[model samples]
Target: MEPDAPITIFGPDFPFAYDDWLTHPAGLGTVPDEALGTEVAIIGAGMAGMTAAYELMRMGLKPVVYEADRIGGRLRSEPFVEGEPEIAELGGMRFPISSRSFFHYVDTFGLRYSPFPNPLTEAAGSTVIDIGGQTLYARTLDDLPPIYREISEAWDSALERIAGFSGLQAAIAARDVTELKRRWNALVSQWDDRSFYDFLSTSTEFGSLTFRHRELFGQVGFGTGGWDSDFGNSMLEILRVVLTNCDTDQYLVVGGAEQVPHRLWTHAPQQITHWPAGTSLSSLHHGAPRAGVRSLRRLGPNRIEVTDRWGDTREFPAVIATCQAWLLSTEIDCDEALFSQDLWMALDRTRYMQSSKTFVMVDRPFWTDRDPVTGRDVLSMTLTDRLTRGTYLFDNGPDRPGVICLSYTWMSDSLKVLPHAVERRVELALAALRKIYPDLDIAEHIVGRPITVSWEDDPHFLGAFKGALPGHYRYNTRMYGHFHDQHTLPADEQGIFIAGDDVSFMPAWVEGAVQTGLNAVWGVMTHLGGRSHPDNPGPGDVYDALGPIDIGK
Candidate 1:
């Protein structure tokens, strides 16, 4: 195990312990007898929505969940059209072990997982780093080019020197709320207004390197994939990713990541209240969620009305919107009075990263085989400066069909193929892959048609996830602490809550979604005149001492 820092209990972003709230024997909070049968409107049946619904149902409140699309939402795992028993993780493929809040559900539901096939992992078999027309195949980072080594070292040195990365990571791991706040808030104040690219260009360690080195750093980032698209984003966002180890020690669900939400919807836990012994979230919804929420309106003082796409309307004392905030203006008919002007500006300013993925099912894990002459694996997990940014290979079993993510790209690369058909997208990806392995015929091993996704084109989800821009921490704090700022909001808007990855300080992570969902649940419980257990307090319970990290202040 890594060396421990001074241990202190605090939440990941704030000082509130969301994990404790969920595991507490008393449950989140108990509503009054009158509020027992009342409904709480939950929009978007994704990870956040389902989490809130599951907890609300357990606490005796009926959550009327409305999903615009499928149950999994952005956690979609596309199965092969031919039914070859393989899946393509179009969204949210890998999960970091550090995400305790999300793993709570994974552990409770007994969902099996394995190490994701990232570069250099044993599951990856071998990695091929193709950059600047030079392709190198290796099993570990040591075998990479000297320039790549320099780039990696420079990044480490820059983080440690500029942001106190090592100490902050220790504090985060130890859950030392005091130390984390001290370190994180200081860094946020320093870097919240600085772009990630600015940090790279200004840091003495990175500045000493050549322009080629900086470009190489962007082309191939430390853990998951490249960081070029994130250059313009806030350095604070990148710091959060590194501090939380979001890119390391990752795992993928055994079957599909979507199963996490699907299982939560139907699993009947033992600590539930009001509901019968075998009750589940699906049972409360009658096995099918209501249609998509078309409009959200403030119906007088504390009553918020929700209208579904089918023209049916229902009133709830509290409403939690787990969908992307952009949909509030684009897809949903929302009353302008629901949010303050500054909050509206923040919602409009939320930037989403465009992501695209193309996957193919092959006859078997053919990549495991080695060539006779060169003695290298046939197809290796690839990271390249080519058109294909990242390529992953998934082996279900030695004999069963395998899945290959031909290309996983973001930003400009993703938008380039937004108009193309899935077949053409696959062809384009294959052509790029052929550049690295010209002699290999990837088409021959194909067992089914390819599956592709361009998240920007999906109306339900405008983009993959929020990529916080420079000076966006204030906006994030506003969104995340909306529950706490009820006194400042209009009377009609007090009962409405927003919780999702987009509203979290750590966007693009399931952990963020889960944490925010718990926040919303706490807010709704209090709005319905319920109080958190004394032993386990919600975020708002301790907001006075451990308020949000407002860099703007």
Candidate 2:
């Protein structure tokens, strides 16, 4: 951890208790040696690697996965208190239905889901927009200026049409960048130079309506602070995401988000080997005809050598590098130029926002303030300018009181250290609750302080996922371009294949990671005569099975 970095209860020096909790058996563990040298080698057991491994297994290929840390990478769920009815998620939470693939996977895996409570569920109906200390009234579309409202309504309608285009949907399903770009550009050109706020302001009849809409948009899209992002790009991306995931309907896994990966592993066969702890990949050596190719020695295209963390080197015909893109490009031996220089520059120009997930266990079922619109319990709340920005309230049922999980993203720049940051966040969350329910005293009702997880400082994932910048829309289509182009490496050669949300068709999210894994598998299969598992069909076949479903249809 950097000395000058912010302090939190979850930081390095905060004792290994939290670390121990994170690395528990349920967290992440290495596969035993007997499982080594399988058909494929997958590094990193996060969603991407795990999903890739699952897909590979479905294709009849059981790959050996190597993970330096716990499984589920950013999808962290831990017990706030031993013997509690439910565990708390310390990483990513709230999966929007807009992620069609993810939702399909959940359904296919037989996972259960339910809707999350709306934070505005309380009777104190007015939406509050707090900036610094001042609270402003939030306006709606009906309150907007006429001209701006008209344009916004028209633009929104147009966006909805673009999102529902069958070609765009097919392109996304196929992971075809060229096709997607052709469709996206055609749709985005309508408001190419306009900011979403500006468009809303100018297109509406009520300027106040535009301001209110921007305020809410700022809170949801870019935290509490108003976003300075390119409206055209952001709007298009948002619409595309909505259409892709079908977010008009949202759901949460009944057990928890972690259940998604658990199901994948459950579906895996027992014959698949799991490497034991302290086992290093360098110590293992394989002969020709291995399930997956291994690069061993530059000797005549048949062998290649791989050095593991323990300094042991072995040869293989092929290897899959399912690690972060930056790690795969620089740390592992690969063509640095596989990705366009502009892509790398764009990646460098972008920085992931830091987030700290804090899970709080409370004793009461507080639904006194029911939102008239959503009618669901307001378990989740987003604060405009506070240490704990978002909260997810889970109903533990009458038998057990509900638990509140508060997530704070983009906190690195606001605080000085991890410990202090967490403490301050807890204070703010408690204060916010008080503001929402003055009669409900938090200090007295508080069962435990929020347990925080800082993704920015974690060694495994240096940052959450790749974030986009103003002009980076071009690269959005290029995400995973290297993997899809089939030119990531020489035609006959194979080494490490990178897989993660950063290399997926969409932005950073669980669905992106899953898709990236599918893409990686395709790359690997293409290198091996298109031979995947005999019993299980590959992704291509899966796509074929889905048939040519039209998006708008």
Candidate 3:
């Protein structure tokens, strides 16, 4: 089947088949008549949804945003000790410099950022690993055995190769298909359909390097144990990271990543009336075409029904969905078949790894060690002891007064075991810290425990971000095809469209979400033609084409 063709699937019972639910009196009654009319309806008020709404309002379309939870879906900030001056991120923390669009929005919105120092420079304590029951204090990757070195080399090489190409166009521009094919082959080979343990068993590097790589990968990637975690999991994600790093320099957002959407909301034009709460979209009735196409449905063409905690429903013409593709596939009663089959299959194949980040507050500026590369005290420590993955420190700078934040990234599959796991993790992290800063009392200086955000269990978020498992990348590429090049809908199929990070070229980062929302709005405007509003022109008029902007400017 062609990639862009609509997907159809059959099963004993289509779990997502919403026809029955939509037609049921309870379901139909859930939607109210008042919600039958509006210009646009936006679901999920994360960065993607907010950006889309901002763009729509700029184009003269008033959009109503429906959020199941807080406006910032996963991009949330929590106070560490409640009323304390310090704030820590419980969800979606870092933003790489490679995210050009995200940075542009930050700059355009006047959000500020301090330089994030290299995280591996500072001396933390050390860990005594029981290798064959003989405990030894190990510090750096060098402490790993020879076998682990080989695996690290392979992982690093794969990363470097993917980092070579700047963009899809640049990759395609290479005249030497042989070299390209060779490189692609090497990278694709890593996505062998096998479990991580199997791959490790085949590897000659079973010492520290192997241990370090597995722990780090599990912590950063899966968020728990590397035991059953498949190395081939999320092949597309690995590719996306390599491509993003290669494309441009990445940076973290200042004052937390949530500021990106908050800025967009602030900058939205005044003409657009963001509908009040309690709007719900019912059935969409259409009329004949006028000029091009006129949606006779009470709501313009983008019909959306929004219900709050109280269950009041309101409608809008157009709706933009910017949450996880899986959530939308299952939760929303739209064309279930259009998104469900692939989504369900992908979800079944994919598993979310648990991550726990502990932020440690130090008494003073401790620059005990310096990174050879970045020459900064901020340390990025990776453990090979199977206890935890790694820890990254963010120097609060001289202005913040003895404030240093350390993030311990741990991977676990079970949230039920998180508390005990976290206790073990803290113990291990402190033990590792003692190796480097033996003279300093880490326990005395340690003012608080780490804050954990279980992205895997977050009811609204189901997973940290979208990741592919083994063969799922190919399937995603195929699924993404359905929405990318499609034309605007006719009156018959008006008011139904999808947008989110899951629909973009990148996988599950801020860049992907922003790019997807931009494309969605652009596509809508292009189909509508004319001016979207008086001041803001439609997509064709605003920009030559819907593509990535050069964020370097």
Descending-lDDT candidate ranking: 1, 2, 3
For residues 92-150, could you state the per-residue lDDT of candidate 1 as single tens digits?
Answer: 99999877788889999898999998997777889998898989998888988788889
Candidate 3 Cα lDDT to native: 0.46
What are the lDDT figures for the candidates, one per model?
0.86, 0.50, 0.46
lDDT tens digits, residue span 381-479, model 2: 444555444555676676675566654555343232355566676776677656644444555545765576666666556566665443444554444
Question: Listing every candidate in turn, what is its Cα RMSD in Å to the true structure after a full C-alpha superposition?
Answer: 1.9, 12.0, 12.5
Q: Write the per-residue lDDT of candidate 3 for residues 1-553, one digit (tens) a residue.
A: 2333221110000011112221233211111223322266667778777777666654445556666766566677655566554556666666665455566678766777654332211233322233222333334445645544555475555444443433232432332234444444444445524444444444444333546565544433321112333354545354445443522233545567776776665553333333333221111111110010111123334443444444456664445566676564445444433334544465344444555555565654454455465454323333333333344444454545233333334244334335655456456656755554455455665555555565665656676665456645444443343333334334434444455655554555676676557646655544344223333332223232322221121
Worst 10 residues of 2 by lDDT: 7-16
- For each candidate in turn, the TM-score is 0.97, 0.68, 0.64
- Supply candidate 1's per-residue lDDT for 244: 75
Instruction: Write the candidate numbers in order of decreasing TM-score.
Output: 1, 2, 3
Better of 1 and 3 by TM-score: 1
Once superposed on the true structure, which residue ranges of model 3 sit more than 4 Å away at CA?
1-38, 81-85, 114-230, 246-249, 268-304, 329-351, 367-386, 398-407, 410-439, 448-450, 485-494, 526-553
Off by over 4 Å in 2: 1-38, 82-85, 118-182, 188-213, 220-236, 245-247, 269-306, 312-316, 329-350, 367-383, 411-421, 432-436, 487-495, 531-553
Better of 2 and 3 by TM-score: 2
For residue 198, model 1's alpha carbon misses the true position, in angstroms, by: 0.7
RMSD value for candidate 2: 12.0
